[model samples]
Target: MSEHQPLSVDGQPQQLNQDEATQLAEELKQQIRNGVIPAGDSDSIERMVAGLGDPRGLMRLTFAESLGVVGKAAVPSLCRALSEHDSVTVRRAAAKTLTLIEDPRALPVLLKALLNDPDPVVQGSAVGAMAAVGAEAIDGLLEVLINPNSTAMQLGLASWGLAFVGARAPEALRNAATSDHAEIRCAAIAALGDQIQSLDDSEARGLVEQGLKDSDRDVRAEAATLLGKLHNPAWAAPLLEPMLNDPEGQVRKNAALSLMKLQATASRPALDVRLSQEDQTDVQAVLKLAINQLDQAG
Candidate 1:
């Protein structure tokens, strides 16, 4: 078949025979491996891959992998496909390709797709791509997290992305911790705790303390859980101890669990007091467990 002639398989376009498609893919891979796409030649390669007529999506995946092999050189065309392509399959393939390339230039289009893509798979791919860009993607991810228009799922994905964006992310997290928007603040605090290993004790403590005092019960509960993950004895008294008295049962339970994780012997007295007055059976059980853990440690 002529390279330009569109072949049909099950009524879907199949531009090249299997052998021809494979040969073209291999050639692109070799060129990519060699770090040369002959300058301005990437557009041609992208066009060829985008034209592949595989109905089952296997050929599209194969070609997308080849685009990934092409690396930064393929970014411009891939970004185009991600933003301008009419086919969701092609757009999704482009997003995957950009993720493999991990070029920061793809950030704008990737962020756009993450927020607006009608396809969940495409939005997820954009999230993965943002993560693949690492530190460079932090600002854009933060923008998404802070946007009131962002969906709960988008905020969750952006928060997850921030956790993977390296040490620079904490600065954004710090800002988000105090956002007027409760969801942003909650997500930021949760992300801050997730990266506690990368933070200094003071930074972690300050952020978690802020969360524990938040008016929102969800933020307080998340903070209590984060403190447990940190396992810092320093937080047991000023932080976890007071949380045992929080009106929110979930917060009290999390605080007790955190105290247990820290093995805070000092919290034993407070745990005893909480257990005597705790109305929720679950919170009381956790308080008893905290007391038991402290006893064992002592």
Candidate 2:
């Protein structure tokens, strides 16, 4: 019998196969889960990192998720994969695993990927990972947003990550709101909406109010949505009047929806007039809904 002969299973020679390899991989992953990752186990860490580039998508994802289970010991290998891996899939999975690990040490690598990665998917995953890191990642993410070479989508992702950081992110967001770039400004304005509850009343109101008058229609629409969330009836007329006359149908719809939230009876007359001239079917429906809401409140 050859020394390399297949193992016997119930007295029959069983050939080593793909199924066996997969089972072995799974068992190793479980062992890592049970805290078998001894210090200085560079070989095991390398094997797990290599598994992240597996041909099978499920296997790749499993390895990525398992990195978190491997804990801090996996960070160095994962970071190397994130920065040096030739495969975008491997790099993307590494970014995701770092996020799952939530180690602050990964911030620099994630920020680099968010700003300069050729692949948008990798950049997007990096953004999500940055958000997962929360307040600690804000300064680095803000640097990306302000960098001249950053793409529009990159700035947008940076804004979203800052927004996810919420109240902890006001200073960076405030500066970004005034950026020379319109997309960055719009993203910043929209992000402020997420920080409303944490902001002082005047600060929150001032930021949203500024956004309401912004030249960008998207900014104005976002302001209207945030105003509704504020639910401060004092500003209902400010929202109801100018916005009802705004050129953008979406802005007009948002204004009407905000009025509905405030139950501003004062807006009923203007809304009625705007309803007559409103061209978009969707805006007209929202206008009618706002009118009904006001009537019910009265």
Best by lDDT: 2
In model 1, where do residues sit more than 4 Å from their true spots? Answer: 1-17, 33-42, 48-66, 69-73, 83-90, 103-105, 116-120, 134-152, 199-201, 236-238, 288-298
Residue range 1-298, candidate 2, lDDT tens digits: 0112221112211122445437746876677678674333656666667777667778777666666777767877777777777888778888888888877777777787887789998998888887886667767776776688988898778877878875665676777677666666666777776566665545656777878888988888877877787666786566557799899999999899988887778878999999999889999999999999899999
Report the number of the highest-TM-score candidate: 1
RMSD of each: 7.4, 10.9
Mind giving the per-residue lDDT tens digits that candidate 1 earns over 181-270?
776677677777556765564676687787889999989998888878765678445678899899999999888888888888877888
Decoy 2 TM-score against native: 0.67
Clash count for each candidate, listed in order shown: 1, 0
- For model 1, what is the C-alpha lDDT against the true structure? 0.74
For all candidates in order, the CA lDDT equals 0.74, 0.74
Model 2 segments more than 4 A misplaced: 1-24, 38-40, 143-152, 167-185, 197-206, 213-221, 229-257, 260-265, 272-298
